[model samples]
Target: MADNLNADLSCPICIDFFTEPVSLECGHSFCRDCILNASRAQGEPTGSIACPQCRQNTARLAIRSNRLLANIVEGFQRLWQPQPAGSGATPAQCQLHQQELRLFCSEDLQLICRLCWSSDAHSQHSCTAIKSAYTACKANSIQLLQKKLNEYRDTHTATGLKISETLEHTNRLQEQMAAEFAELQHFLQQRERALVQRLRAVAESAVNQLVENMALISERCVLIEQALEEIQSTQEQTQFLREIKGILQRCDLQTKPALKTPELHLGEFNGPLQYTVWKQMLNIISPAPVPLTLDSESASLDLVLSKDQTMVKGRSKLKEFSHHAKRFSNYGCVLAREGFTTGKHYWEVNVESIDEWIIGAVKESIDRHSAFALTPSNGLWTLRKWNGNIYGPHHATESECCQNMNLQKVGVCVDYEGGQVSFYNADDMTHLYTSTDRFTEKIYPFFLPFPETMTKGVLKLFHLQL
Candidate 1:
């Protein structure tokens, strides 16, 4: 109610309690000074004065001091005291018109009286019963609040999902790191055990040889001592001479074999331990075991496939064999008999005898009948030796020219899950190159003997040492 009372007394111009009230022809009231200032300023520009509330024009700007209304305002001022909560005995009335505030102005969204609605200021504005307006607005407010609540809920759900993904990623990284550490630990233990075994074998072999030599010498010494005893007991000169001659012939002291100690050719353990462990990782971390053989069905016509299918030689004249659809008709390439689906695999190739060769893995369905570019994108992951230089796929020039002409064997390893394929020097376990690619289908070992103009090279599968 106090809210209603204060709003009525508020000036439309100053928006405060009206001072020395005045009324114009339009019946809208304002403070005396407020009306005069507005009228003078408005009429000075346009010869007609307009009512501030409705903008209605009039011939005159005569605003008379509302003495009767002023006196009423003064009398009512004493009654304009603040109301306390729930003092619902008497309803608050409009201080301007002394009317009950029963109507709600939809445009202003506030309570008003019948007199306020009658004025041009609110005549065109939508008005309704205060109770009806409150009911409709409350329903809309509830929906709006619920919509805001749903938005917050969606935000929380998104935040939670992000948190879960982050945690999962963190755990995966931790697992991979842990597995690598465990692999290193296991490899170190295995290496230590192998070295210890080798040391024992070397020591045992040397000791056995020395012990055998000692036994032979002991027997020879006993024979010499026996000869001396017999000679000392001999009374005849011929017997003594014959015994001495026999002893000297049996025991040739001057011609005794020289004692030689076997040198233990154990490899140096004092170099970089970390480097050694890292190199061994390549041998142990294979995705799968690949014992491969050349597929005779996929061999080129110029290739002579060995009976064991473990070797192929490039020849000038095409070999006499039954033609097959799977065989390469245009290029010197061959695929392995077996293909890998997943995991890691390792295989070695003896390329020392071959003058030129291309060795790596390839997708099983690679194009083999047409003239093709040997690149990774073309399903080939190979390293080539041409003109005594080593090159990879799609390379224009040799990345590493084969400086060591004595280079021979190379080991290839693959990891499907890790999407890695690496080549190494087989003799010294030295890294040559590594290619990284995701596998979409089964991959097979690829080999080619790039024979020189004068020499027909051979590509042979290297057998396991043990």
Candidate 2:
């Protein structure tokens, strides 16, 4: 009974017991200050105020104070004290009117008593039972939490897989390092043994030559001694004199410069030891070039690929190939099967005097259906040979002219992490051009054997020493 009376005494605007209560012409009442504030918020220019409960406009801002309602609210306030939580004897009540909070205002997102819901402030606002609002809001919160939980679980699983992959890669890399070191050791041992053997052979040959010279000198000495003794015994002067001339001539011939000891040719061993070894090791230890082949799926319709996929050429008749999203539709181009996202890679192409050809590295995301110049801006870091004698790096506005060198083979080296694509004359590994640009995605080897004008040139792919 107290709750019912308290509700009747409360002002709808403030959801509290009326203070200085005032009634509008519509017979519904509100605190005088509350109604004035609401009127100013409405900003009506007619000098009229709208009743908070009925929305009826009054001609003047005449708010008549209700002494009866104010007196009742004062008495209610004197008797009402906030009910404590968990006090099993009494229910929770509004602080102002001491009425039970029954409904939730959807707009204000707060609890309100029955009278507060019917008040002018909330008459136009939607209200729902507290239990219904709690159930709906809790379901939404749980749904969001569940979605995040699933996402976190998926991330955890993916991280585990990545960890496993890293371990496998690490093991493989260690094994490769061990194998390479063993091979290097073997090469060094073989070289050392060969050098020692060669040195020993040289020493033995020199000793043998000296021994032969010594034996001849000993023989000459014996002959001269015999001749001297024969002269000394001189029983017959003429025989002695005849033998002396021959002996003298023989001595001169034998003594004529004993062969100089053969000089030992140290050859390469006499030079810088580490430098010589390094020079020799280059032939055996150069990095193996990246193996690349034309991707038939990415070839233009007018291009023909060889059976091994290592060579490509242009053909007038369109090939009967399947429609692929990556196929070059508007350009006579093809990409290698392999794409690189990291590390340095090198591959060679034999253009073989192709009048219209392009060789380079292109981003994997380049447009396939639209035509664009093979330029850096277009994701193609390429060198082109056109009109049979002209060579240049392709650009959108104009090709940067390069001195024609009749380049037949081109080497493309892409350092993905370094963001550089270098072109070389494959015949001598001469640097032809290098394009330095930012790379954020996978890059593929690009090739265009022949343009639309002539369709008979071929380009070949091969691995070479870098």
Which candidate has the highest TM-score of all?
2
Looking at model 1, the pairs that clash are 287-343, 287-344, 288-344, 288-345
Q: Compared with the true structure, what per-residue lDDT tens digits does model 2 show for residues 15-88?
A: 55676899988889987766776777677556788876788987664768899888878878667755466776
User: Considering only N, C-alpha and C atoms within 3 Å, which residue pairs clash in candidate 2?
Assistant: none
What TM-score quantifies how close candidate 2 is to the native fold?
0.46
All candidates: CA RMSD (Å): 15.3, 11.6
- Residue 126 shift from truth in candidate 2, angstroms: 15
Candidate 1: C-alpha lDDT: 0.74
lDDT of 1 at 200: 83
lDDT of 1 by residue, 441-460 (tens): 99898888864332645677
Residue 375, candidate 1: Cα error in Å is 27
What lDDT does the true structure give each of the candidates?
0.74, 0.77
